[model samples]
Target: MTVWQDDVARDLVRNVGDRLALLTRGEGSHVWDGDDKRHLDFLAGIAVNSLGHAHPVFVEAIAKQAATLAHVSNYFATPPQLALAARLKRLAGAGIDGRVYFSNSGAEANEAAFKLARLHGIGRNGVAARPRILALENGFHGRTIGSLALTAKKAMREPFEPMPAGVEHIPATIEALEAAIDDRVAAIVVEPIQGEAGVVELPEGYLAAARSLTLKHGALLIVDEIQTGAGRTGAWFGFNHEGITPDAITLAKGIGGGFPIGALVTFGVASSLFTPGSHGSTFGGNPLGTAVANAVLAEIEDAGLVENAARRGAQLREVIERIESPLITGVRGRGLLIGIVLSSPIANAVVAAAQERGLIVNAANPETIRIAPALTIGDAEIAEFETLFTAALADVQASLAASETEKATAP
Candidate 1:
């Protein structure tokens, strides 16, 4: 009758408070918690589960690869690793002959990209003492030391000071971008869509401007597509939508479909910058991770999930926007990545209410709730979310009204 309460007993890193739910298993777009309660998952493992949980294809791919070969050191090569790398490069486009470097997470991907940028700076100009790195303010790359240095969040960065050096943050504006980029700069990194900044969509032509500025300054432009990559943005790559190519691109999150994998894809001279001894990942580009990535990408392609995400995402936004609730201000993002801007800072309250109603969502910020479910989610599921989200907002607002009334009466 009872399952483990998961009392935060492990003495794990205490960033957030106690656990919300101990999820037992997941299938399709739904998950069952320890209590056996089913909930529609819209967060999708923070955009990691591209194909939903325990997807049969992904599961089989992992199992088969595990039987054949799960891992091999960077000293060796496997068919899956080579194939997946080639596939990713093709998806990256054919304009540049690119090479792929794999890692275990988005942070690692960004870290590799960072190293490549530094090497690129050294290789290209050969005059600067040290190349400075630039990233958009509020744009999240990852949490590792090198990647963290590039991230723009002060609170996340301040706890661990003196990050990797030569890194600077700038506002996501053309003017700031124009001012910051120069020959001495190694790279300029930007998330085509700011995921952690409440799924904030970047302004149109921003990427184009970044590419232009970086090119003019002879700096490498690195687009961190960790969140927006793998069909999440209704394209193979978010940068693809803009029609401009960056010198380098970082990927992870959805690429492995719940499996831990990351990659740095670089084109042109940047691709050849990393010589034999420059960089390496022991567990990176292993057989198992690449196998799953190929399978996940296959499913995304065969099932038309990318187009589905675009379709359902539009409907999801439209249905919620049509609610015209006073609590909701607007919806922003592309494809399945969505952010509902709340009029008040009641996003956490809204998340709780939605969870109680059998729909799982995330209060991405004080006033924003993010919806990033599986790309395979259909219209029916989208309709359900609309109903649940509207009700959750209503409930939170009504509770706020009641609390204010009680306060007034007490005074």
Candidate 2:
């Protein structure tokens, strides 16, 4: 008889095929599989469970809201929905004039933000020559048609052509940006830290430079904080580190503390782009998602998770540097979003070996291991992870040495 994993492989969609069966359940920084085996989770549901799994606050809020009201149509306003929008606006420093739109996922958030940008430019051009969206190379926004058009990976996008038009890709540099922006461009979309592209951090002044270029050309600046927002980068939002406010910000992952939710936040002039009936979601700002999100935000503040993330993230980086392995090229990231770049493309092997040692990790790319652990993780978990991680690297070293010797003695 075929096992559940085999059935999954055969029946489920091939996209992210085997990755879904890796970890079954989670609590704090640990997860257990269907085989009753435990693994220390450094992935944290791809940085979604900031409060960790099965947190009491989240559970209670969801349970209470489920009892009260699970979902309501967009025709009416709900308290939880209004409360979350208010809190996010304050965090964005968008003043009292900001507006919010809810969506079911990150891609939807980017989709809405794109619509807002296009609408903002419509008044100037009369819809004849629409403003083009300029995005960063090696940057990932989302997989939806419109947002996918903004994504730079050719392999992920070639099959889906004729995507919503007016999206352009340029290099991730000030010079590249300065050359790309023109009067017809609507917005420039970027990730504060390119999380999926190996947690690549922006160069100092890169954001400010982009802001300047966009402002000079009258192009809107869109910061896609979907992966790095909600205190994941040790701040309310990743762009806050640069102290630059973007025209629009997209957020998801960890905002709902694992619940499916996304938000499009617009400030000042951009706020009025979406009038009544322009866009809406049936379950986007439901009581269930918003109630839990409100609780998650309150819990983060009460526990000082943002500060803890900064301190622990720095400590974890220092420990990783102490590994001093020749194969390790460098460690790059801020807060808990870390990426350890290797000199060779042995990152997949490292992930397998780490899994064998009862640890869960991810290879963001062929040569980089991304680590975005839970914000609630403590010293003990990190200490154990460092020890196991060093041992895993040693295993990699031994295997590589044997492979080299075999190559030298090849017949």
Pick the lDDT winner. Answer: 1
Residue 411 of candidate 1: its Cα lDDT? 50
Query: Which residue segments of model 2 deviate by more than 4 Å?
Result: 20-22, 128-130
Q: Model 2 has how many clashing residue pairs?
A: 0
Q: Model 1, 1-411: lDDT tens per residue? A: 123443455545677765678898999899998779999999999999999999999999999999999987888999999989888888887344788999999999998998987786664456654468888899898888999999888999999998887888998999988887778898898998898999998888899988888888888889999999999988888998889988889999899999999999988778888899888888999999999999999899899988988888888888888986788888899999999999989888988999988899998898999989999898778878878877887888789999999999995
Q: Write the per-residue lDDT of candidate 2 for residues 306-411, one digit (tens) a residue.
A: 9888989999999999896888989999999999999999999899889888888899999999999889988898998998898898899999999999999999
TM-score of 1: 0.96
Q: List, in order, the clash count of every candidate structure.
A: 0, 0
Instruction: For model 1, name the residue pairs that clash.
Output: none
Would you give me the overall lDDT of model 2? 0.87
In terms of lDDT, the poorest run of 10 residues in model 1 is 1-10
Alpha carbon lDDT of each predicted model? 0.88, 0.87
